[model samples]
Structures are given as structure tokens and as C-alpha cells.
Target: MSIEDRKQKIIAEFSMFDDWMDKYNLLIEMGKSLPVIDPHHKTKSNLISGCQSRVWLQARYENNRVYFTANSDAVITKGIVSLLIRVFNGLPPKEIIEADTAFLDKIGLKEHLSPTRSNGLTSMIKQMKLYALAFKTKHDSDKKED
Candidate 1:
């Protein structure tokens, strides 16, 4: 599915829950569903700095889209990472760049996260976007070389 469709689906799913706790629990559960990364990839270089929990993120470009794998030592943090992965994964560089995370505010994710947690989340997101930017730059440079 397209990222837009997935966004809508996520919004819809969150709407199904009446309480923030329920939604938060569902987000954590979503994190549980993320595929595991290799232990070797969990090094300090992969760690998302500023996160209260140890979070790791890795990205790769394939078939004109970006794919990511992530993990966190804390379950709730993992869930937050999963939400970010879902929102950004499989999107082309341009699309990923264009995406506005305003939905996060609408979903009350930003409001509910503690200040430190919010900072961590922001760091994680910036890292992911950097990956996208790097991919886009390399792709463009390669095309120029060709």
C-alpha cells in the first residue's frame, strides 16, 4: 500500500480506540510485530542518540523505495519506532521528504510523549530523513555520472 493509504489506515485504527492508553498499547503491539535486526547491527553507530531507550535504526534503498529495520530496548519506545518505520518505510525519497508528520499531532502522539521521549522521537525521525536524503543524493549523483 502507498504511504498515504497506510497513514489513513493508521489514523483509522487509532480512531477505533477510545482512550489514549489503548492507542498507546496498540502502538507498542505494533512495535512487537517489527522484524528483528541482527545483533551486530545494534552497535553504537546504529543507536538513535538522545532516546531515553536504546533505539537502533537502519535503512536501505531498494527498488526505488526506502526500507528500514529498527529496534528498541524499551517496549514503548520500540512501538514509537515502529510507528515511524511504518510511516516512512517503502516510500520513495521524494515522497518521504514531502510527508508532513502533522498526523502525529492529530493522533496526539506528540502531545502524550514526555519531553525527553519527544526529543528522542524527533532524533529518530531526523535520522530516518537523513537516510532518505542520502539515498536521494546518491541516486541523483549516480544518474549524473551515468
Candidate 2:
């Protein structure tokens, strides 16, 4: 599905819960479903620097698309990253880099997060886009060489 469609689905899911506590529970449940990051990719190099908890993100480039896998020491952070990956994964690097994240606000996630978690979320999104940029640059260079 397209990123907008995936984001809309998440917004609809979050809308089902009237309380912030319920939304937090939903995030934790979503965390449980996040795929575990490979042990080899969980290195210091992959760690997101601004997060209070350790967040390791790794990107793989294949067939002109960038795919991400991430893990966080904090459950809420894990869920947040999972949501981002759901929207951005398996897409072309340019699409991943350009995807709008306003759905996060529409879902009431950003406003409800603690200040530290909000910073961490921003770091996560930045890192994802950085990875996409790197992939796009490499792919563009290779195409020129070909």
C-alpha cells in the first residue's frame, strides 16, 4: 500500500481510542509486533544519538528501494519507529525521503509524547531520512556510472 494509505489506516486505528492511556496501550501492543533487529546491526554506529534510550536503525538498499529495521531499548520508542517503518519501508529512496509525517500529529501521537520522547521521535525520523538520502545518492551515482 501507499504511504498515505498506511498512514490513514494508523490514524483510523488511533481514533478508535478516546483516551491517551488507551493510545499508550496501543503503542505498547504495536511495539510487541515490531521485528527484532539483527544482532550484527545493533552496533553503536547504528544508534540514534539524541534518544534517551538506545535506538539502533539499519537500512538496506535493494532494487532501488530502501528498507529499514530498527530496535529501541524503550517500548514506546520501538512502537514509534515501527509506525514510521510501516509507512516508509520497501519504498524508493526518494519516496522515503519525501514522505510527509503530519499523520503523526493527526494521530495525536506527537502532542501526547513526553518532551524527551518527542525529541527521540524526531531523531528517529531524521535518521530514516538520512538513510534514504544516502541510498539515493549511491543509486544515482551508480546509474551515472552505468
Would you give me the overall lDDT of model 1? Answer: 0.83
What is each predicted model's overall lDDT from 0 to 1?
A: 0.83, 0.87
Model 2 residue 104 CA deviation (Å) reads: 0.5
C-alpha displacement of 10 in model 1, angstroms? 0.5
Quote the lDDT for 115 in model 1: 55
TM-score list, all predictions: 0.91, 0.93
Off by over 4 Å in 2: 112-118
Model 1 spans > 4 angstroms off: 112-118
Q: Lowest-scoring 10 consecutive residues by lDDT in candidate 1?
A: 110-119
RMSD of 2: 1.8
Model 2's alpha-carbon lDDT is 0.87
